[model samples]
Target chain A: MASGDREESKCCFKEWMTTQEEDLSELFQALTVEPENIDQLKQLAEKSITHFQDYIKRRNKLAHKDISAYFAPNWCSPWENSLLWVAGCRPSLFFRLVYALSGSEVESNLTEFLLGTKEGYLGEVMSSTQLLMINALQSKTISEEERLTMKLAALQEDIADQPIAMIAKGLSKVGEMNGEVEKVLDNHGRQMVKVLEEADGLRMNTLKELVKILSPLQAVDFLVASKKLHLCVHNWGRQRDQKLGRKEIDEEC
Target chain B: MASGDREESKCCFKEWMTTQEEDLSELFQALTVEPENIDQLKQLAEKSITHFQDYIKRRNKLAHKDISAYFAPNWCSPWENSLLWVAGCRPSLFFRLVYALSGSEVESNLTEFLLGTKEGYLGEVMSSTQLLMINALQSKTISEEERLTMKLAALQEDIADQPIAMIAKGLSKVGEMNGEVEKVLDNHGRQMVKVLEEADGLRMNTLKELVKILSPLQAVDFLVASKKLHLCVHNWGRQRDQKLGRKEIDEEC
Candidate 1:
């Protein structure tokens, strides 16, 4: 990988960790909540944990998948060491959280560990609680690119609260490109985006044409062409994590 | 990355996880011995846990350093995201072991957590016993290459015990241009290790002749060139693991 790729990987690791700590801390708090119905709560938590264990086992396959991808060409043994080193030194934190929550159930988890690699040692966490934790967090997990795309789509929808003519104003001749209609809105829900006050009806017609040609999501991506979704993802993560931390213990992920 | 590299990486991960499970299992057993000792024992374990945490931090930095090295000629976020992606994962087994051991210290280990990562978290387990467990493991952690070399060395040593002088002598002539010595030893001792047999007689002369030519370890490495040190390391691990497990309370690395 190039230097840039390596740097991106590091950033990815850091981000992953931050997310993990939040999940675990939240899990701990839930464990401490003396629920009004202890017996019922225990049953539900146990079930969640079982589900999480399954999720971990699936993710374990990921380690094998990534490393094998790296070693396809030369078939040399030296490179394998790097992947192994990584595995030994740092496993997926998500895996740990699930395993931790499962607590005593870990012993059983080993028997279920099934990866194509058929590696000698790494099974997985045994308990059910840890598994639940894994599943819950994993559901929200998405790559940086995917996360960004999702948010940009959201942002576009947010900006769609405007008249079509007003939203189309930015387009000089967008109809031929995506055959779409525009409905961009200003912060105060004004028609600042769709229609260009200077371009007259020509601008609005072109903008509307562009919007109609593109899918709703595609239109948003095009509208924010020069921008990245990182900021939006981060904002979403913050709000989501807080909600996660405050969630009830027995709720399904 | 190709299919082969990915496969190799996956194998390594599995092996690593296996080793981790084995090691932490040892530590866990150790901590459980004086199960009732609780807080006092936890304080001691905490020393080890703290060390383990430090090791994790340092390991991440070092791993990143390698990526940084690879990217020296090019620059753009240093490929940190990828690095972090791998680094961010936990040695799940290790953390699980830590959390489990804390069970004995129940009240003493339970304490408030502090936030470190912006949106995530990091918190102290409180008990010294937990820290001790972490520290003890860190003290023994070795990188992948060192581990593999050790394993390979041990295998070589085991293989050397077998005798086969004809093969060794034949090896000297066939494609010997590579300067590779294939010393097939006898089950007992013999012609294959002719150099070994002649060593004692030539020992004094050889030392005098090459006193300035080698470092002590290198010399030893050469002497045991056919002996596989890897097996020795593996064996050490097995025996030590057994002892730790049986004892159920070792805090020493």
Candidate 2:
């Protein structure tokens, strides 16, 4: 979270939005392939929406599990803490994409759709760290230091392509110190070092992968389209419920 | 993070939605004071939306600062970690409220509003801890142990308003230990003890304060309305852009 890092992240985020727009436009074009295929397209879109909803719910589960691990002494890392805010954006982003493709159709059922889809996505981005943290907390035979040493080794394997040998070595030495740390306090206590030093690079890589997955569609232009679609459908559903004076619409949430 | 805590939090969220719905309805009734004041109402609403947008931006600054402190060891806490997810819902909640009041009007200026408002509110919830942690890290004279002891003392004062003496005492004792010995640690190593022990109680307190602030408004039922308005306005803007082939609409984000 250095000022330089912040500037880089902001630039990266803008670049991502630009890429998503292009990809979404392509997806929309592909979907419009045959106006005659509209029925099939709607069916497929509905299924995709449902999958997105499930994905959101799973992220909530993951957040809860990860937070559970955090209470255990050594389970949470500083990099993971920094990433939590960004990760929370996933659910809204997912909903935005789905709502965009679904068009401006707002109905009684849309309330159910919005209400049913709950949760966020911090869990997905930090999945590897969360799993390892949870396992370390649960393992009875291994000491916390041993667990950390293993975690560092595992990270080295995961980021083999990245140039993070220094980070790996720093963490490895810290793990080995095992709290008997009067010897090399200066070495271990550098100012706010991030354990996952390459997290931003990894996120940019993931964004690229996501764009690839979202490419090949028609030209709907998701950057603006999806957000507007979300607003329209949301308001439509609200007005419908208001027209009915149905208090129960919101009770389901 | 526990099943029971999740259930309780879910219920609390539902209650919040219901309360918001009631408040929105009241606000709408007040806005139609004479129907002749329609222009003035629109102006006031726009101002309110701008204020909400500023609030969201302030939260982003807070998050960046807090995340920076997260790199400093032991500065962040488990309770703070769990709260980060819930804190992030504030922006969407603010937008939903404004959009609910704004009706279905999707203007060109509104597109800018949608694109301009970006970021969430995780940092606000953990600001107190982040400040204390950063201060602890930077203080030249105070040992880490002394800083922790001071944190425990502050927590005792804060929770004195509640009835959590056991939690306060336990943490205070842990603070005093200063990493002394590592025996009999099983009692303190429950996977999600933080979730049930402090989270529910803390959230309930926060909810009570929020309700107090929101209680005076009249009831037009914003629970579903706000979310729907958000979606409707969002989609309306996007569709407008799509119609214009204005690819630059989303570039601002």
* lDDT per model vs. reference: 0.27, 0.29
Residue-level lDDT of model 1, residues B1-253, one tens digit each, is 2323323333443344344434443333343354344444344334333443444343333322122111110110111112221222112222222233233224322432132221101122234643564454433332322243233323223321212211221232221212122122112123212222222223223222221232222222122210111122223223322322322121222
- Residue-wise lDDT of candidate 1 within A79-144, one digit each (tens)? 112222112111122223222223322333444454333211112312354335345443433232
Q: Which one is best on TM-score?
A: 2
Per-prediction fnat: 0.00, 0.06
**Candidate 1 error regions (>4 Å):** A1-253, B1-26, B60-65, B68-86, B90-253
Worst 10 residues of 2 chain A by lDDT: A159-168
Q: Each candidate's interface RMSD, rounded to one decimal? A: 29.5, 26.9
DockQ per candidate? 0.01, 0.03
Predicted complex 1: DockQ: 0.01
* lDDT string, candidate 2, B166-209, tens digits: 12222322112222211111121121222222323333333233
lDDT of 2 at B214: 29
Scanning candidate 2 chain B in windows of ten residues, the lowest lDDT window is B180-189
